[model samples]
Target: MPEKLPVYRIPDFTPAKALSRGIHVADLQAHRQKHAFVQAPHKHDFYLLLVVRNGQGTHTIDFTLYDVKPGSVFFLTPGQVHAWDLSPETEGTLLFFTPEFYRGNREADALRQFPFFQTWQHPPVFNVQPNSLSPVEQLLHQMQQEYSRAAPFQIDALRAYLELLLIQLARLYPKTTVASEENIWPFQLYQLETLVENHYLEHLPTSFYAHALHLSPKYLNELCKQNLGKTTTDLLQERLILEAKRLLTHSPHLNIAQVAQALGFEDNSYFGRFFKKQAEITPEQFRQKR
Candidate 1:
């Protein structure tokens, strides 16, 4: 079997005390120099917001390759595998924080409110216009300064800046149907997406997620369709197919049957048929193409 992908937690890079508070800010190039291992494909347990002020390269996130350039901003949620190769001159800031840190005294679905952070709805990366990049750069620098000072109530100050930064970026993001005070359905949809992420490996049905959300399956499907233009089953199947592809492409040592079993498919043949139906390609073909 292929070795399991490395999963990094905030404590891996930050001091133990910061681990409790769950936030880290760093100079992008300096951080990269200090931790060369991050250049390899790996997963993180905390959320990451990386802003590239100047760079030239590629950042591959969950199999999608994005250009790494000036004004590029990348947001990564927990469990999304990514690796990047930036120029030696790359300059930017990286903000790492846990859900708990961002959600302190806020609603449970706070982080999900940002469209970019909702990977199911939008891509994880966006580029800021040079004219508009100044504000964002300032916010990042302010956060870095506050993080280094360790002043009293520093956590509160950092959290406030983080939210402001998210707000600024949201404005730059392509307009979409985002959660708002007048609408609770988007929040519910976010909850459902989160549930799917946590339970997709189990191959749970829509009814299971519906019950967990205290909504009927039919209504849940309606919510999904209205917000995401997809049914609950479609969401679940897509999540399964994404993970299957990830395993097939990254874990070359694992055969088809092993990948199927890893994804909770008891029968390799059945897994093959399911994969082809959803991905429109055989597992071997997909693996070879990748």
Candidate 2:
């Protein structure tokens, strides 16, 4: 087995500090071989997309693992926990950009309107069709050429290409069919979900929200699962783990015990195992490096 590594940020494929402009591009031809180890759950300030050209692997985003095979494509939005488990032989192209790359652009606002940008009970995982891969390949190839352009309009030109790429992917997104109703999709029920996201830290169980929403647990779960693809417990647990990762990676003051208590875990051992089950890394190890 490969030696286990402590949690750490994957080094910038090309050092960010070295770039003079707002964007830089590189073709990560050897990413899979070098990045085979499981990265501790963490988020980034920028956005990235990994296009898998060969091999198969799994990617973890927000506590959900999606199977990735040849021709698969994955997107990482800003500030989402993600890690990859790759075979040593995996090969792909990685695209990275700062938020500025999309800033002040109308398409950026439209792109954010996609449902995948929401807190889905499951991360969006789209299986790439064999035919769709060619456009992605062409986009990457075009992007590589644009990166080396010496023209005065390079930033605007690159942004236009980038917008086109997002538009194509957005078009590919499968639209959810909704049936019209008077109290359609239950707007009030969705308000309850927002309540859960904002205040799950109280460690309130399903009943608590049911009471607040004036609905039975059975009703709430059925409604939430229909729209969000998960039961209330799943959403709560995912949010708890998300916060745990934040505390683990972003905070330096708390040790494992303190962290567990702060997150409402009364038993330290159980908390450790629970975190490992969700994140595939023990809290102590996750906190030590990244």
Candidate 3:
């Protein structure tokens, strides 16, 4: 049987009943004091920007452990399971906001361009240098202060500050070695990624995507390889594996075969092999491990 990971639907992001919106920022110590869920593996539906101003700890995100330090900043995406272990003396600031809160009505699709939100590949932790983090911390402090006020255009001010902070953080974020920009997608990798994201459950083939985009399969493959350093097939498989992992670990009611079929895999055995090949563990093992 698969393990049922603890799932948390924060009141701030719940849509059924109207909840207070906009940025929610507070001192980490204070937030911890009010909330008992500090060190539990759970997933939420809002963005979390954690700035560790002091002390040390370990943050477990999606089965990977990251050391937490004073100068580090962590960007956690929605639906990514994570938890934290920190000392009482640890002090910092935490900011949480919904996607609509930050972007307003602007339709902010480009937020994914940031490395941390590239969920398929990059680990969502940023260890900012002590010297370089001064500016970043300053911006976070400003945003926190602005969030406390009933001032007009408050959302505008907060959004502008958030955008600046994300841009600045991206600059300081260490580039990934495996996912380097090889040729810079001058073509349509983003479009291809969007198409895959929407239709990945259909188990569409690379040729189908190429045809939909009106490009030759060879050209699409080349574009994906140059931009993401992976062939089109690998890219699609990565998405499938990620979804399968999510369902397996988070949705324990779905058995192995059911999860495989949901991911558009026709043969359960083939799906298990493919998952183990990419994730280094069989589907059942992964579900139980989590």
Best by lDDT: 1
* Residue 67 displacement (Å), model 3: 1.2
Clashes of each: 0, 0, 0
Model 2 alpha-carbon miss at residue 29, Å: 2.7
Error of 2 at 7 (Å): 10
lDDT of 2 by residue, 1-290 (tens): 01122333324444444232355555555543454442555566566777777777788876578998886778876656677777767777777666566664554333344334444522455666747777867877787788766677777777877777776665665544222344245553555655666677787889888888888999989988887777888888887887787777655667778878888888999999988998789988887756
Error of 1 at 28 (Å): 1.1
Assess every candidate by TM-score.
0.92, 0.60, 0.81
- The total number of steric clashes, by the backbone 3 Å criterion, in model 3 comes to 0
lDDT (10s digit) by residue, model 1, range 109-197: 47887888888878898886666778888998898888888588988998899899999988888655455656544667778888988
Error of 3 at 127 (Å): 1.7
Question: Model 3, range 1-290, lDDT digits (tens) per residue?
Answer: 13466655456332333224556777889888777665677776678888888899899887689999978889887767788999889988887777777667886466667777666556787776677788888998898788666688777888889889888888888865224576443436656766787788887779999998899999988987766678999988887887787788678788899888877778999998999999999999988887
Instruction: Give the alpha-carbon lDDT of every model.
Output: 0.86, 0.67, 0.77
**Against the true structure, what is every candidate's RMSD?**
2.3, 7.6, 3.7
Name the better of 1 and 2 by lDDT. 1
Alpha-carbon deviation at 156 in model 2, angstroms: 1.2
Indicate the worst ten consecutive residues by lDDT in candidate 2. Answer: 1-10
